[model samples]
Target: MSGRLSMCTICPGENEQIDAVIKIGRERRSVIYGTVIDENRDPVADAVVKLLQVCDNGRIIPLTHTFTDKYGQFLLGPLCPNQKYMLKIYKDNITIRYDPIDAECSDGDCIGNKCKRHDSGCK
Candidate 1:
């Protein structure tokens, strides 16, 4: 009876399969395409990009906006889970403004084309 009680109370290693399982069960990280360019497909730095979450009513509500880096790379979320979104890119001189692009969603996350979702947008 004593041995049974001790075994029942004893805990396994803290760094074992349990930890790995928990980690795996956690939400997977999301990614987005991150590059904008001119007509020649060359990197266009310092461009502004706007991000919006698409509602069921088809309304375009602004979420956030970011500027492209020297490499013309930008990132958006972690945005709303299981929601569609759109992205718009703008350059003052090099080219005309771009229409918003539809964000592709997988799992509970979203990826902005040429954009990275925020690291903590998921809830």
Candidate 2:
């Protein structure tokens, strides 16, 4: 996609045409998919799953969010591979956070090497 802008801000009678080309390149994006489980290793349905971007200034920005299915499976996708991300899972009045999730994996599957196991409940 691309766009152009033409304006006459300084002078009313004089219209200036500024040729600005915005070339939107095709950036490689990946998905982060995983399952949500409880302490008993059981699927937790309807759990709120959030994908967040961790900025260098220690500010967290929410990218996307989704809820777990009946099987406790959730997928958040179309994410930029170059940025760092974190996962926040909320269930049963408790919030579980997983940091430094790799979104640049080939298949974007969190069940394998892309995901790291934390002390909080998550599979």
Candidate 3:
């Protein structure tokens, strides 16, 4: 009888450790959060506002709508990656606040074997 012998893929011959990589495509979404402030830089509560995405050509894209909480903190959800944004806050029947900032989604998810941490800042 003639036969050929081969090692199993899952088990590394019971002597060495095996490493596996599972690539996961993450959803490109981000949350916009910040404290609302007035012209005096004081926390403004209960402010109704809309988040607008800004373009390099001076165009405005309406993103989402939200209101500031008691602590002057607001969160707008699921923003597109690599976009600039400005918050339009209104009061006394007029637009009174604008804050322009750049935003981006998280690069990857924090999970699995890649979760090891070194002094280089990934923990």
Per-residue lDDT tens digits for candidate 3, residues 9-118, read 47576678778764545556777778878779888888878988899999998877888888888877777788898888865546768899676534453666454343
| Candidate 1 whole-model C-alpha lDDT, 0 to 1 | 0.69
The total of clashing pairs for model 3 equals: 0
RMSD of 3: 25.9
lDDT winner: 2
Q: Which prediction has more favorable lDDT, 2 or 3?
A: 2
Report the error of model 1 at residue 87, Å: 0.3
Prediction 2 global C-alpha lDDT: 0.77
Q: State the displacement of the C-alpha of residue 32, model 3, in Å, after optimal TM-score superposition.
A: 1.0
Per-model TM against the reference? 0.52, 0.52, 0.45
lDDT per residue (tens digit) for residues 6-53 in model 1: 112336786755432212234433434589989899999999899887
Off by over 4 Å in 3: 1-27, 38-42, 93-123
lDDT, ranked from best to worst: 2, 3, 1
C-alpha local distance difference test of each model: 0.69, 0.77, 0.72
Q: Local error of candidate 3 at 34, Å? A: 1.1
